[model samples]
Target: MRALFNDRGRAALDAAQDFCTTDALAYGPLRSEDLTADGSSLGELMTGPVLGPLTVANTVGFTAPVAPVMIVHGVHDASVEIEQSRLLAQRWRAAGAVDITVREFDFGTELVPEFDHTATNVAAYPEVIGWIDRLVARA
Candidate 1:
């Protein structure tokens, strides 16, 4: 997901924090495996507003861990505005996210150069996998 949607993510988090609740959309860096169980339903839905339901993690209330997050984005992403990730990184940090990494790829000879929304998935796979592995190890 784009994380923060027109500041709604921020608003939701703020409301929860003020109300002493935990039902807001908890920011997370989703990986492919995380969506396999949905049979690619999420794949089709992510580009649209259908994932709105996922904004609430648990209806009954559960405290999602403020896990370390890393947003690997292509500066030239066609589907999502780079600003969304930037604002999300900022908001998540302000909300007490201890570890937030925004690794961006521009149009140079750097990692994932000539980046695009879908290209990032293949170009940055190794780095993304490593980050996930590290997080899992910590867990």
Candidate 2:
């Protein structure tokens, strides 16, 4: 699910962090299973605004000017599924986004063939910071 709505994954984390009043949530690369849940949460948050008309525009339209988006997820992220990212990438491509890059890394729960989710294994700071730096510089 996190993969499906990579756009809001971080936002949900932010919300959760604020709501929890602590940094209990973790971030890192993700796996397919991790996405099923995390992706759903993020999607819900994003679509909530869209469907509830919380934003200026009520729907996802091509005319909306959006900046380039960068997503970084761990391949072994058990909290969110890796496939979610694939789905989102497809949607963004369909939406005519040229600079969207979803970077997948290897830092999360141990690789189990049939697992759905795993615990975060590493701090996703350096790489994430680098990506954000590049994006900001480009912007």
Candidate 3:
């Protein structure tokens, strides 16, 4: 039982590392401590690290033709807040790019009940696929 728990702990750590690495890769190095410190709001932290890339990504509108942009975001995500994706969706809509969908889930972090940092996104994959299907079928 101890071994099983150990393995799970390691897996969770690995997932977190991967998540951080991916973010840095996309948006560049972040003052991770500042973002995680007490009294630091997620929205404030995201203003630079996340929103900067989003602005660039949406500058010319989605070139793929209303390709049913589906953002599977964890509502309680600590690394990246749902508001980031929510803002993205809103920008996409403003760009006249219809058929964008943002889905939220409750599984990501195990240690922090409020932070869903784990990759339990598979739980919402089916519904996300259906959303994409409907968007694709639209005129």
Candidate 4:
């Protein structure tokens, strides 16, 4: 998804970028030595305030919407793991969402490695359109 960043969003992005660069330089490159060191800076980066909070928030159970929901995830997506969508589907089912479909496309079957995030809209365009058409027909 794309975000229309206003002033606050831009400021947050700038701050995150600055923090990442500074941390990377201070900690040096990610190596076995660095990871197994006394204080794991890479570990800190992974569990830091920015990423940690988002990770927790995503996994936390919440009341799902009372509407038909379709979740599509690429099996080989490196950016966002497929488990994210799986967990979301679980939460939706628990929250009483009746018409929820969780679709997964294997690597190079219905998705491409290069278009990890946009595979649903790009490589699987026809399937997506067909899904929407079926949903509309049901409605």
Candidate 5:
């Protein structure tokens, strides 16, 4: 993931900002501390004598997009707060993007019957696929 912050990967990210008729689907998306959240695996491992890349992969500074995006997260996820998704949506809307969707779910809402960081991806697949189908139809 650190490679995403390098010169070559940065160029790709810069180009993604100009999305044209594309769709984004994020499930239980976790944010790094740098992206204005509480948890970070890198932070935990990057201790003394284990230096690493300074740049982290996150959407903290991403600007508004030309295409629509959907972010799904669990309401009671212990590892990552749903607030992170809200913050991203707020930031994108503040930048003038209006099509960002942040979907939140609770336990017993799907086949898995539990909604957490890992559970969201599996439980939400049925609805998520339909969303992708709709997005494809629009395109």
Candidate 6:
């Protein structure tokens, strides 16, 4: 998360941006199925020797103190489940973060109408702007 990069805590951010973020790495090694589904070459690289070993939970854990985080994810996300955001929020709380929030959106196909894994930034702009205004005012 961008919040983790701030050295001066919440004051360092005018606002924070978060899209579909995964709380935990998916189980097991990368499979050909993942590549075909996502069409990402990066997925293959992530499973390679360089990034594969670093993909573990412990390696991906977030613990730094920073600005308030506003996470937005689609409820029916196929790439990363919404539960991952929930779990990440839990982890942030367990680690002593109090200014984190998660917002779920609905968008998808007819069969699974809420299954949108990718949403445009415009869809969340208003909320993001409001969040930034509030945080900036507080700062």
Pick the TM-score winner: 4
lDDT of 1 by residue, 1-139 (tens): 4342324433543565565212322433434434333434444554445565665442221332277767888787755778878877776766667787778876533464333466766677888889999989988
TM-score, every prediction: 0.46, 0.44, 0.47, 0.55, 0.53, 0.54
Q: Give the whole-model CA lDDT for all candidates, comma-separated.
A: 0.58, 0.54, 0.58, 0.61, 0.61, 0.58
Q: What's model 3's overall lDDT?
A: 0.58
Off by over 4 Å in 4: 1-12, 15-61, 108-114
Q: Candidates 1 and 4: which is better by TM-score?
A: 4
Q: What is candidate 2's lDDT per residue for 43-122, written digit by digit as tens?
A: 45555534345532644433422776666666765556777766777667787788776777765354552332322223
Model 3, C-alpha of 25: deviation from truth (Å): 13
Q: For every candidate structure, what is the RMSD over all alpha carbons to the true structure, in angstroms?
A: 15.1, 10.6, 11.3, 9.2, 11.1, 12.8
**Whole-model lDDT, model 1:** 0.58
Over the stretch 1-139, how does candidate 6's per-residue lDDT look in tens digits? 2222233222223222232233213222344333332343455645755557667544432683477888888776666778887888877777888888778887663563333454524467889899999999988
Q: How much is 99 displaced in model 3, in angstroms?
A: 0.6
lDDT by residue for model 5 (42-131), tens = 455344123343333333635898788888888876657889888888888999998886778777434533334678777778888888
Model 4 C-alpha lDDT per residue in residues 1-139, reported as the tens digit of each score: 0022344434444655668423434443334223322343444544655556665676544777777777788777765688888988998789877888778877653333445666654656777788889989988
Q: Which tens-of-lDDT digit does each residue in 3-121 have in candidate 3?
A: 22244333443556668534434444444333343434334534556555665565544443355577788877776778877877776787787767667786547665432444536
Q: Which stretches of model 2 miss by more than 4 angstroms? A: 1-65, 111-123
Candidate 6 stretches with Cα past 4 Å from truth are 1-53, 111-115
Where does candidate 3 stray beyond 4 Å?
1-65, 112-115, 132-139
Candidate 6: the clashing residue pairs are none
